[model samples]
Target: MQPQSLQLSGIRKGFGADDVLKEIDLSVRPGEFLSLVGMSGCGKSTLLRIMAGLETPDSGTVSIGSRDVTNVDPSDRDLAMVFQSYALYPHMSVRQNIATPLRMRNLSLGARLPLIGRMTAKASVLSKIDAAVNEAADVLQIGHLLDRKPAQLSGGQRQRVALARALVRSPAAFLMDEPLSNLDAKLRAHMREELSGLHRRLGATFIYVTHDQIEAMTMSDRIALMSSGRIEQLGTPDELYQQPATVTVARFIGTPSINLLPVEIDASGRVMALGRPLGVSVPARYAGPAMLGIRAEDLRPAAGGFAVKVLRSETYGADRYVTGHLADDQAVCIVMRQAAGDPIAVNGEGLSHLVFPEQRAHLFGADGNRIETTVPARIAI
Candidate 1:
């Protein structure tokens, strides 16, 4: 099937007096897997529903490959949506569920009944449906479960069945709204690999909506990080992680969260953290209150850096994370990579010196926007 590009322009939506989507504009490339990710009530699902023609936007247009589909019906939009719920018929077998779309589209009402329809239906139509069903089953590796009902299959198998049903249609694009949210952790991880592999094999456009940043980071070609009613940032996983445009984007995209410390710029334009000079300089224009953001990995153990008293420590196999508080009442965390030879111990009373390289730090202004700064050639560590 030929892939189609999906585009949304000037999209806005509201409920009663509350505005949900505000001037949303996004363009999805052909055969690309784009994820719309944000917390609940961020309007990611609503934007997806508009793309699927499931909901009408208050304003703006939706186009698929140059054809406007804003006002089109869901079925006529040439899009297939897989909801969070499996939405499979409990009484239908896997084969029947996979064949439902083809059957509905190709068969007449009188030709769809139990025994009478079989006699009235064209042999060519039945044969085509069977071929499509088998092909979809084979693609999903669920051919052996054709005779099983939804009640008999595992959650992952049921999800695959639902995907197969969507696959049989060969729609222009696929819109999935948290389809794997119900699966257990291990199964969800497995399904992430499966879905990514399926996208590569099919080369079909995929718009995945989820609240999980991990899901978006792992599988998407580009992530559209939605917040409130707008896209805060849209870029590849690395770009969003390493260079976030706002404090919200930085806070939302990483695991264990980025550590933010209140900072300020001295009269000499030097950045200061915990009331101590950080040996980094910002522009004279930014000589005021700021926020210093650093990832746990960047906070390394240095010989004579700022002192922090360990408050707690947690181990996860090969790594240990020590959480502590600075003398100035600022919280800090250091991720110690476990290694042989040198053994490090973290306890409630232990004191450690932590330092983050000047280049590794992120400076945000009082309004939560990133502040571009210049580092001095010489620095005291």
Candidate 2:
């Protein structure tokens, strides 16, 4: 099947006075897996609903492969949506559930009745539907469960049935709204791998919505990080992790959450933290209060550097996470990652000196936007 591009422009939605989404514009490339991820009430789901034609935008255009679908019905838009709830019928067998969409689309109402409809429907059409259902079941590796009902299936099995239902359609694009949220952690992890592999096999356009950063990071070709009704950043996982566009993006995309330190940039653009030079400089126009962001993995122990009072440490098999507070300001805490057995140089007072290369740090202006910086030439030289 040829992949289709999905696009939305000037999307604005609100409930009462809330304004859930504001001027949202997004373009999903053909055969791309794009994830819309954010916290609860961030409007990622709403944006997805708009794309699927389940929720109409207040004033915007939704296009699919250069054709406007803004006013199209969900069924006629040729989009398949796999929801969080399996939504499978308890009374229907797995075969019936997976064949439901094709039946609705192909069979007339009179031809859908259990007994007489089977005879009225064309034998060739019925055979085609069965073949499609079986093919979808095989793709999802749920062929064995075809004879069962929803009630007899496990959480993972039910999810697979839901996916099979969606896959049977071979729609222009697939929109999934947290389809794996109900599974246990182990199963969720396993399904993540399966979903990624399935995308590679199908090569279809996909728009996925979820609040789990791990899911977005591991499965998506690119992630659109939404926050408070707007996209904080849209980029590859590495781009968001290595070079965040905003403080919110920096804070949301990382596992440990980037450590933010209160800082200031002087007239000379020198970055200062805890009244000490941080060995980095931003543009002179940003000479004022700022924030310095550093991921846990970036900080290293050094004999002479900024001091932090050790607070606590935890081991997780191969690595250790050490939590500490700035010696000068206990209100500011930081976490550092190191190999489990690596020794930390802690003095009698429970203080350790830590340092990070200037280029490894992120500087944000007082307005919470990222400020590009450079290692002072002398330091770089």
Candidate 3:
């Protein structure tokens, strides 16, 4: 089947007094892998369920390709969903599980009966189902496990069987809700690559929902960062990371999390942090308190930057992270790459000059909205 784009417009959902999803509007391009990511209570899964027709939205519409499936049943929506749990039948072999969908969709009620149905079923339909099941098994490389039951398969193997079952349907889109969450760390990492490769090989539109930022970052063409029943930001990983629209978004998209420092604009329009000038200028019309978001990698050791007393240090292979506090008791961290031989010793009295490059700083206003700032040619660090 040809790939189709999925779109959700003005989607809203709620349970009792609390609104779980509020006015969510998103579109997935054909063959694009889009990940809906957020914390546990952030409504990512609710939105995915709405897309799958498992839950009806209080408002808005869901469409697959050009057809509106808002009121359609899950089966009639022509999309396949792979759940977090494998949801496999322990009593049935992998082959039978993979062939179940085709059997249900292609066979008549009388023809589907146990012994009588097998004899009454058309030879051509059975042959087609076998061919499709074999093709899906080959694609997932689970042909050898066809005769095995769920109890006999490893977690990864079972996940592949679930994927094969979904693949055999050749649906317009695939909706996967944390399909790899049940696997161990190493296996989950392996499956991320496998799934990414599978998406490319099949060229199918995949709507993956996960709370893991790393999975979304490494696998999705674009990510929709949701929070408080709404989509906070939607863009490519780099776009969301480097140019976050809000402080909340800046805090959610990175590992170790982005460091936020309370800052203010002076009478002359200069931004200051920890009582030292940041050498960046906001518009003269703008004033008052704001936040300076600096990624760990952006904080570098410089000669004349603000001095911070080192509180602790940790090394991970070739990289070292130094955590410290400024004179005013503000926290800061510096990430050093390829420093196998160079270690930043942590002493109560040790001081490090840390620079926050003006161009690399992300400025957010008191309301949490991002504010554009300019970096002067020369900084007063």
Candidate 4:
């Protein structure tokens, strides 16, 4: 097994009385691409900052390559980060910008000068820096843009220059904070493909932080889903989608999101929804009020399913959504929808019956914790 290149042990941070992060444990394997994702105010950005050594944590240890780097300065941590704003030097040429780190690192206090340095024999240092800068530009396909300043570059070009600047140093890992957020929707999608290809070419560890679930789902090997300053779940996209550990995670992921219905358990370990037997075999501990989580794909018209009137139908270009209201009262969970042309089940009068496949049905107990159980048999109405 490869050792982890980046590790955060029991990390925490807070702003005075407000807690921004709880004890968070994260690991990034060497050459692995990991994404930290969550909504606004979820501390995702804060965590990324901590990883970059830009923000000091209230408590916890940060280690890189088996060495503790908790007190290391951001610049001394030997890591490069790309910001969302693409903070390029407006007046500097692309080559100068890309060579900035190397110049800063290679030059001595007495040798680095505006006029005096030009007369000194620092040819070797300058040559090495130029080679590194050009090599990184070539790899990023930005060699042609080296002579242009940031003002003259397009958004994509600027982004590649920023990436090239970061990569020139050959840092241990790349830290990206919403790097693609500034791009338009179509460009963002295109960049996603390009970034994946770049990752393959470099084989370097990537730690990306973003609010976009699709970005995390498609690009990362695994994701740490954070919420309210704490990690809610950590797993693959399929794992979280197919088997969410809690209601929050289930609701957070997916295109249309999963529909959760209020339900109750009977004396025989059976779940009752809309005052009818669901035929779902719930756990013995389930009783009183519980919620039934059903994905849009799991929803259909019911022959014996709980009856609800259709409110409306939503149609997209390629898909039509069948959304409707349920007779049950309490909250909006009763309302549901599914893709059109689904053979699942629905009443003729816009009534929605959640007909989840026995193998696909998910059960959550009254405590909001998902209960592990098999899907209930579909009854033939």
Candidate 5:
């Protein structure tokens, strides 16, 4: 299938008095993998449904390539939707299930009736449908399980069958709504890789919706991070991680969660945390109460830094996470990521000083918006 661009313009939706999607405008490139990701009730799924024609927006237009598809039926939109449920026919064999879409599209009403339908369909059409089904199954590596029923297959196998069902149609785009959520952790990880490979092979547009940032980060070419009916940030995985547009994006994108410290941007542009200069500076216009954002990996044990009383430490393979509360204020806690072999010296009082590099720090104003900063050449401490 030739990949096509998808666009949603001025989308707005509400449930009763609660607004779910508010003027969402997104454009997806042809053959690009875009993910709508966020926590529950963030409108990611609703937005995806609007694209699939499963749900209609209160206002807006959905277009495929250059054609408007806002009023088109789900089937007529030339898009295949794969749901989280793996909606397979429990009684149908994998071959029958995978062939269902092609058969429905290619056969007449009378030609769709089980055994009798087979007699009414053209020999060529039947053969074509069979070939398509077999090809899809092979692509999904499920050719060996073509004769098995959904009940006879594992979670991962059933998922492949579901994908095969969608693949057989050769749709312009695939809209997936957390299709791997039902799998175990290990299987989910493996499927992420498989999905990436499949996208490369097919070169078709894919719009994926998931609450898992890890999935979105690892698989998507670009991610639309939605929050409270708005896109908090839209960028590549690395862009979102290294330079989040808002404190919410910083908090949501990382595994350990980015460390947030209450800070003040003084009139001179120096960042102060607990009345001590953090050796960071931002625009003077941003002077006011602010927040300091730092990733765990950026914070390290340094000689003359803010003190944190060590509370806990955990090791994961080659990395170690040390969590502690600010010594000056117990309300503030910090987590630092370090190499497993790195030595951390804790005084008798179980205190360690953790400091972040000026260049790697992030500053967010009181309203949660990111504030651009400039790093000074010399340390103030």
Candidate 6:
């Protein structure tokens, strides 16, 4: 079997009294693109640094291939990192910058010395460096910008140079720390497509860190969702969006976010929200206080349902997000509610309650696990 590109076991970090990462354990298969996403200060960057051998963890171990690299220096990790700032050398041309890693990795002190070094280096070293640099530039489509200095390049061009620098190394893995954060929204989106395409062409393992769920969903083979120094859940975008293990992950992923309503399940495992049955078939003992989670699209403006007072609505070209309240019950709270002010029955005519489709209801027990089965087989409350 092929070795994993990267591995972390019991990874943890702290700054004085504050913990930064907590027991991170995951692996990136060779040639797979994995993304680490989380809110600020959630240790996503710290984890990436540790993986790149730039930072030491308070505890835990990191490995590349079959070797334990827990204390390895950053230069010795056989890894390449693309920084968010695109850390290109302002004075160096694109070619020189991309050649930097190859030069440092393969050349001796005398061999790396400008003209003198070029003449002194073994014939083989120059050829290898030249080949690697050209190949990298070609792959990143920066071959045309090889003569341009960082100052002369656009943001996207500089980004490509940074990527070229990393790619030329032919490292075992690639670590990217919000590499697109510096680009404008459109460019960032465009780069996302290009980077994913590049990853496919090279088949190199990629570990990307970002706080944007859209980036994570669109680019990753799988994602490790971090929150408060720990991974909340690790899964594919579809799995995460449709079957999130916790409410925090659900709320963190979606744009409009999942709306959560406080609820209670009776002794018979019948769930109720705002005094209306949610039709969940839970175990008899696992009843009492609960929460009901559903996506916005799961709701429809139909008849014979709870009235959703339209508090507000926002248009997004293709669709509209209508926000409102479920009457006067405080227990029917929207966990990620954006609705403000008075409720609007809107086109509901005279509706008073937002009737939830019992079949689509998700029930979270007190311990936070989704209840396997509720009282009603037809409903998922």
Candidate 3: deviation at residue 241, Å? 1.5
Q: Is candidate 2 or candidate 3 better by lDDT?
A: 2
Candidate 2 regions with alpha-carbon error over 4 angstroms: none
Runs in model 1 lying further than 4 Å from the true structure: 266-269, 330-349, 378-381
Cα error, residue 39 of model 3, in Å, equals 0.5
Candidate 5 at 318: error in angstroms?
Answer: 1.0
Q: Per-prediction TM-score, please? A: 0.92, 0.98, 0.94, 0.90, 0.97, 0.91
Q: Candidate 5's residue-wise lDDT over 250-351, tens digit each? A: 999997888888998889988888788876788788889999898999988889888899999999999999999889889877898899999777888999
Q: List the residue pairs that clash in candidate 2.
A: none
lDDT per residue as tens, model 1, 306-339: 7777776677766666677775575444343332
In order, the Cα lDDT scores of the candidates are 0.88, 0.92, 0.88, 0.81, 0.92, 0.81
lDDT of 6 by residue, 1-381 (tens): 232478899999999999999899988888899999989899999999999888899999999988999999999888889999999988888888988998887889998887898688998887888898899888888888899889999999899989989888778888999999999999999999999998888788999999999999999999999999988899999888888787778778887778887778899777777777665567778778977778876676545676555555776665667766666554343322223343434564433445556666667777666665534543433
Off by over 4 Å in 5: 377-381
Instruction: Between candidates 1 and 4, name the one with more favorable lDDT.
Output: 1
What is the TM-score of candidate 5?
Answer: 0.97
Candidate 2, residues 38-151, lDDT tens digits: the string is 999999999999998989999989999989999999998889999999889889999999999999999999999999997899999999999999999999989999999999
lDDT of 3 by residue, 1-381 (tens): 899999999999999999999999999999999999989999999999999999999999999999999999998988888999988878889999999889989999888888999899999999999999999999999999999999999999999999999989899999999999999999999999999999999999999999999999999999999999989999999999999999988999887688787888877888888787877888856588988888887777777776777766777887767777765565544443325465454335588777766898999988998989887766533
Runs with alpha carbons beyond 4 Å of true place in candidate 6:
1-3, 329-353, 366-369, 378-381
Candidate 6 lDDT score at position 353: 40
Better of 2 and 3 by TM-score: 2
lDDT value, candidate 2, whole model: 0.92
